[model samples]
Target: MNSALGSRQAAAAVVLLFSYNGLVIGAYAASIPSLTARFGLAPWQLSTLFVCMGLAAIASMQVSGRLSDRIGARRVSLAMIPILVAAILTIGLAPSLPMLFVAGILLGLGNGGIDVAMNAIGVQVEQHRPKPIMSFFHGMWSVGNLAGASMLVLLAPLFAPDPQPAVATTTSVAAVLGVVAFVVAWRITPETAVVTHTDSSGTRTPIPASAYLLGLMAIGFGLGEGTANDWSGLHVTQIAGVDPTTGALGYTCVVGFMVVIRLLGDQLVARFGRRAVTVFGGACSGVGYLVTALGSGLPVLLVGWSLVGLGIGMIAPQVYAVAGHTAGGRGLAVVVTFGYATFLISPALIGSLVATLGIQKTMFVPALLLFGLVFAARIMPGREDDVAPSAEAEASWTEPA
Candidate 1:
């Protein structure tokens, strides 16, 4: 569908869309403990759930990127909304383990598609802007994550102590937010992704070498982000020996830090350049895991996770912006697929590792992996990349009229 929205309005609509995606994920993040209890899930079982979700999400990415290019990204993104809602609801309310697997697959599939489609939309929107705004768009996603997790935390006191009610309420909130996001996207999303000549010409723009490096960087960021959103609360309960309610604060702190840095990320990129930011963020988060590993108390845990959040907040938005600016959908697809593979897979991998290594020790894995960001930083884009598109990218797309 064609969009009639002016620039600011279209930007707002995409922001809401990105936020809604994060909101759904946040609801899942908030309900992790409750879902664990509601299903009497063992660590391995949780691993299985994540594996199912990760695999399906990975599968969806393989197709969704090309699909978005074939059709309008707006339509593809809007189509995934209800699927996402149903998946999140099922996750919070599934009666059996098998059904939970179903929920995981559904959620993964829906999320994977929307993730690619929305980024496509975001990149297209950024194409028209004078300054880098991709990071701000992603920052709103962090805000949405904070909102989702905080909503559950706040509502828990009002409900009975049952985990199921919290799960239900969290999903209900997601459902409402999902509806609002769907309406906004349907009415005014800019659908700016190129869909005509490139599709027919059989043109497949080769992804730049740098985009691959960015994808490599994205993996560590994805793993770190997954850990914060999925298991920070549990990390508090297990390592810090806090009550589960207080553990909720762990999730909030990490994502909350993410919100601050992401909102400021574009400016930092403008000032320091993506390579400097990537290297610094990598070092900070790697050390954060070390700090987390050493700390047995709440302050240390929160501080460590806060560092992780801040560092990671700087990584993904820049990666997305660079890839989207230089590579278009296909390159972005390669990057997104690699990036989010770690995003969802980290949860499953950690669930498995946490069983053997324990949560405290498992922190080292991301720490080690994230140090790769420093190595990958060599390929990060300069300040010029923020404002310039690759000639290859210019050939592959025609901005929708």
Candidate 2:
């Protein structure tokens, strides 16, 4: 029971760190339009910069997740703080288009690496904790998103009179906050980490190919999230005829709703198993997109975006929960990282699809995927405790952590 308590504490710490990370990442996104206008880059050129960030993040996911097992998430996460702070600072100082792109790459790598380590350790910590904790833990990301976006939104006007002022102000404040969160969260991690092992009898396990299914699920959710993150604001402005500043409110609404939903998500999942939750959740997301694509007026856009938030709220966390149950030891981390990699890839892929089709139409791509994911939800293995030892034996086959 103490071990379980420790695990929950560990997971909570991971969530705090990521909440800070989310704040920093979200600030960067809000600042992008400013960055684009300041640099005078075309829309396609700006999109390419985001693609660079995605590719860098995807590349680092596996490396960081595997590194966590050997050195520990605490150490890797601690080391990442300085790099992240430095990246954010550099972003503020970026004076050229090329420099901004470079910042994106560095920021993406740091964000990805920290994400993998924290999630890997988080699930391991949740193993001993009572009830479904992963959803709440993952929900912290949304909390971070809310905090980060709120910070940007509040500061947006203050910086608004001038682009230079907005960029510098938002980035600097965000960097300081990020550093403080990292330091505090790092201090809370257990000194004697439980260290995950794959085999019940052995010390380590490798993530199986079957776990790619988890990544596939992630690709679906990632699309929804990516659409929200990248396109919600655009959708409001273009479709609902809102002012650019007011348009961002749509994303703000989504982020705020997601944060609340995720905070309460554990209770929801406990009441309804992951299978039912995921399928219905996907349907909710599909409806959200469909509404945004089809509906007119501010009220309709807000409603659609809000539904989008609710739908995706549990999807990513469930993937982590399933990975934790299916893969043991550091294998959990590896599988989570693989999912992050998909997260990295899907947005750009979706963006290209959007470019080819159009943003409003392109969203249907992820919506369709999530629509299909409703059916795929059945493939996710059942509860960790339900599997018999024979099942465990099959699950425990050869793999290095």
Candidate 3:
């Protein structure tokens, strides 16, 4: 009874942590217009900021992943939460472009560290559960995105005249949420079971080739997602002729569909299997992106955006889940790093294209990228019944001191 109770509590903690992380990201996305205005940043300049953040985040993910392997994900997560909160505050208060750049780096570091640790912990939770629930955790992330975006939309009128107050208020809210997330994280179990393999000579075997294949798929999906996250609002406002608040609604639509689809992803994966889901999802996203690029009106464009959300919603969580099941923290790090590298680069690529071709035509870039997932879907983890326990899966859970 105690074990079951403990499991539920731990699962809840991880979910909350994921939600908080998503909230921070969503708020940042919602604040982009204000940030651009305040800093007088061009599209390329905004992409440059994303590049800085992405580089820092990549470094942090590598270090955090290695450290989590040695000390456990829970500890690393706990240690980084404070840093994350501080960075959020710093970003909100930054008065100049250079200061904002520095804050972006700090935010990226905090976000990357916590992201790896929590995902590692989430993998541990999935291992103990009866059903595949990783998608649901990510679904909660989409929910947080909705909540954060909605908050900004509501607060938009109040802060329209001043960008500083808007940023400060939103980030302050994130900091408070960060505190709550920290408490929840503290309640989760501290130790996660590590997965490893040994060969005939007793030497540890390399991570399975499938993990790398999944990483490639992740990169493709990340491109789609990163483009939507960084550019969706601008596309809607500038191209579709919507107000700034309504422009944010375009991203809200994307996340809204993502939340609904991801919440149901586990059941869909269980019923149809990963290959079918990945292929079909990719096709849907491709079609959706084409619609967004060619659609004449705001309503049509929003529908296309929503379809895109549904299509790619399951890709990242499933990839992370597969990596976690196969190689534990180390595997997750490698795959996530590969995936995030593409995500980070997406803004720069799209920004350059937007400069030349305009935002509407730039949608083709991610549309074409989505199709790559169809060929790569076959490499995803097979059905649960087909998977066998590895030497690392057999390792006993070591409780934290």
Candidate 4:
């Protein structure tokens, strides 16, 4: 193991931190409507805000990756998580538009920093584990997402009528949880040796081809997820001729199955192997999206989305694990950046395509992307390749990023 804690203990802490990040993201998502109403944000403004957050997160990932490689992931995480917590609180309480924008940037930076640093830590811990555990860690992220959204849903009703009060209350609760998680994360950080590199010839190493290939896989998964986040509900609504509230249940099915698949992803990967599992997941998603785009009934839509969730859920953890193995923090950063970019661009890309091709046809885009995963998944590591590579292994990396 990497830090002061044993592998098992470190895995627990990593799970907690992953959940914490997910909670923040879920709370932020759940509060979006309220935030929109409170600020009277125009659609363009909302888009701009997301763009800013995404750009900042990208920058944060790059910086955090290099820093983690240089110093240590535990140290980087200690600094980043607190910033995320503070940013969350600031966002919840921002009094002006300018302040909200500033808070958004910090929120992105903090969240991104935590993502890179903690993932590095997770990779460190995974290196020493007896069996595959990355999926479980990532699964807890889904659990946190469910918990965060549920918190707002259950609590918001108590403060109903004004959206602001409900959002403020939820954010406050999330912040408290964030504080608790930050401490736990530190105490349980894994104790494996950190990966550090210095070129005696004064040359920087280029990222390997395998890492970039995995990044492309990340993009495929990212777009599939982003589509579900924004369009699944709307798509089902139009198809089933139902209200938004009823249509939302379709996407709920997606998320529910997503959480389930991720929770079980480890065993699946272990039994079927990573490459097999990924390719299977890709096929499932591709067929599921096709069913969704062509289906006319609510029941069918639900099944389609369930498949979509199940398939997409299997991807991220595997890719993250593979990327980490490929090049440690730098590779993880690359994959994370590629994956997260979908969140920012997928909506706009789909929306524009919807204008020309219609929503049903546009749904096929992600299906196509998901299908790409079938072949792209060849880059995933085999079960026997779980451990971090040695110096000799590092020297053999010649693939271009």
Candidate 5:
């Protein structure tokens, strides 16, 4: 096992990397209204663009898992920083819709690669620790969301006169943060602690049945998360009849609770166990969407969104953690890929619904998806007997600070 101090440093590096990734997404999210106005795109066109990104992400994730397994996650993760930074810069400089599509592809590729790599590292960290700490790492992601949102709130007024400057400035910040993330990535230990399934002849085995169910849960959770990240601000403005600034606040409220709950998630999972937490959290998220759909005022809508954050915050991390135990890096990739595939369809689905049924009614889609978790939660592996004893012992490796 790694020394206590080395383990702590590795954990910090992983959390910081997660935060940087969230900052990139959050900053782009805050700029969506500006992007819409600048491009003069209908909701469907925007959805199509998201589909482009999602397709690219899926492709990249398919390969990233194998690449991480071969090269070590630390190197693969550090290498993605440049690609991510370049993509962010390109998105800022894009002058046409076609250019935006090209930028989105690059962004998706970088994001997909980094996502698998970091989760692999996260699994490594979890194996050395005695408790569930994946949620705490995810909490840093929420913190990044808050930081990015706050930045937009402060900077939006200064750049409202022109969309280019707003995007340029935001992406510039992302670039700077990416540089910091690269530095942190360098500090991560090169070795991974991963559990692999092997037969007597030392051939790798197929993914377990439990992983498939976990992937399904991830897909449902992804729909809710994707909606919140992509459409929550618009929902507040279009459905609740609020100003853009106020709408941004509603999005902020959702992420704020997400940060709080995820920060405390380890204790919750330890106390209640994985199955109970998954079911309860899913139910809360369903209720939150219902409240938002029925809300007549901004205050009610914001409250509902807050609940949405609280409820959905820990699901992904828990799912990833379980995947980590079951299949290590490959499992993380498979589950995340399945989950993120919702992004491929969700934007277009929601956009079509918004065009016809309206945003309020369309919210039911995510609500239904989240509610599905009630049954799906049954598929997750229990804490006490999930990982094989030999795999656990073999997977532990020293990670230098």
Candidate 6:
């Protein structure tokens, strides 16, 4: 065993930080309507505004991954804290859509930076542990979302007097949470950076093929996540005839269930191999979307979301773990950061799909994609093989991104 706290502590730190990030995102989502009303923007216009955040996140992931590898996760994480706090504050103080867009970009960049840095750290920590801990760490992100959403919902009354006032209040609270999380990250992360080294050539090495595969896998997983983020409410409203408040319940239930399952995922993955877990998880997710598409009423809708949560719980972490093991575990921070960037595209794609197809029917697309994931899981390499080149290596990977 690795001593007191060990890898688990590192994992917890990453998860907690991620949860704080989630809270900011949740508050932003909850406040979107207010933003639209305040600016008198159409749904499409609001979406366009939000796209800057996603794009910035994706770009930052790619840039930050390499930067973290060159510097260290500790520095990158510490530096990102102020950016996150600043971005949140900007959102609270924005006077125009353009200013909000700038804030969104900053927020996305900060979010991407934190995400990649944390995953890199989590990947490092998981390496020494007895269990597969990545899934659980990633799952904690869901827990953060739950906390964030709950906070927004609870604070709804604080802004009930006016849309702008409510949004400002929520944004202010989120900014404070971001600051607190930054302080926690700064305190826990060592000041002197821990650099991962390779034995050959006595020089730091770059991430290898598997790192890119993790990124591709992220693309698939992101698609699934995006589906939930963008469409769950649509299903509830259109199919279940629920009010927006009740429709929001669909996302809440799915995210809540996902968080719980992910929190316990390390134990589950330790008990069962990643391959088996992913296969079954993909099946469950497919079923969940199928249920959402065809099943009637709230009970079915909630079940669909729960199943989706359970299914996706382990997938993201598995990808992160694979990124860590590649290239003798060198450049892991970069791998995770870049791979995550690719995955962030899913939500926008889901939005486009929903626009093209009716929302309820579009929900089925995720199920179909998950069915593909079942096959993808089959092709995924085991933990050891993912790192070492072997005669048994079957999974194809792209050159380092």
* Model number with the top TM-score: 4
TM-score of 1: 0.84
- Comparing 1 with 2 on lDDT, the higher-scoring candidate is 1
Name the 10 consecutive residues with the lowest summed lDDT in model 2: 385-394
Off by over 4 Å in 3: 1-6, 36-48, 95-99, 195-202, 231-250, 293-300, 354-364, 385-401
Q: TM-score for each prediction?
A: 0.84, 0.82, 0.85, 0.94, 0.86, 0.83
Q: Cα deviation of 328 in candidate 1 (Å)?
A: 1.7
For model 4, residues 197-259, the per-residue Cα lDDT tens digits are 435574667777778888899899999998998899999889899999999987898888888
Q: What stretches of model 4 exceed 4 Å from their correct place?
A: 1-6, 198-204, 387-392, 395-401
Local error of candidate 1 at residue 154 (angstroms): 3.3
Error of 2 at 162 (Å): 1.9
What does the lDDT read for residue 228 in candidate 1?
Answer: 76
* lDDT (10s digit) by residue, model 3, range 372-391: 78777766656652122244
Instruction: Give the runs in model 1 whose Cα sits over 4 Å from its true position.
Output: 1-6, 42-44, 92-98, 195-203, 227-252, 290-303, 344-365, 392-395
Model 2 TM-score is 0.82
Query: For each candidate, what is the lDDT?
Result: 0.79, 0.70, 0.77, 0.81, 0.77, 0.68
In order of listing, the candidates' clash counts read 0, 3, 0, 9, 0, 1
The collision pairs in model 6 are: 159-166
- Per-residue lDDT of candidate 6, residues 16-101 (tens digit): 67777777777777777777777788867776766677678767777666655556555677677778778877786799988888
Q: Show where candidate 6 strays beyond 4 Å.
A: 1-9, 191-207, 241-249, 327-357, 383-401
Q: State the displacement of the C-alpha of residue 284, model 3, in Å, after optimal TM-score superposition.
A: 1.8
Between candidates 4 and 6, the TM-score winner: 4
lDDT by residue for model 1 (1-401), tens = 45533388778877988888888888897788888887789988987887788788877876777677776567778888989989988887788889888988999999888888888778777767766677788999877876888888888887877768877888987887788778767777876656432433677445568768878878888888888777888998888887999988887788778788888787877777767887888898888888887789899898998898888888887787777677665666778888877775676688899999888998998899888787887667666676556554532565556
Number of the top-ranking candidate, with lDDT as the measure: 4
Q: Candidate 3, overall lDDT? A: 0.77
lDDT of 2 by residue, 351-389 (tens): 687779877777677678888888777777654432111
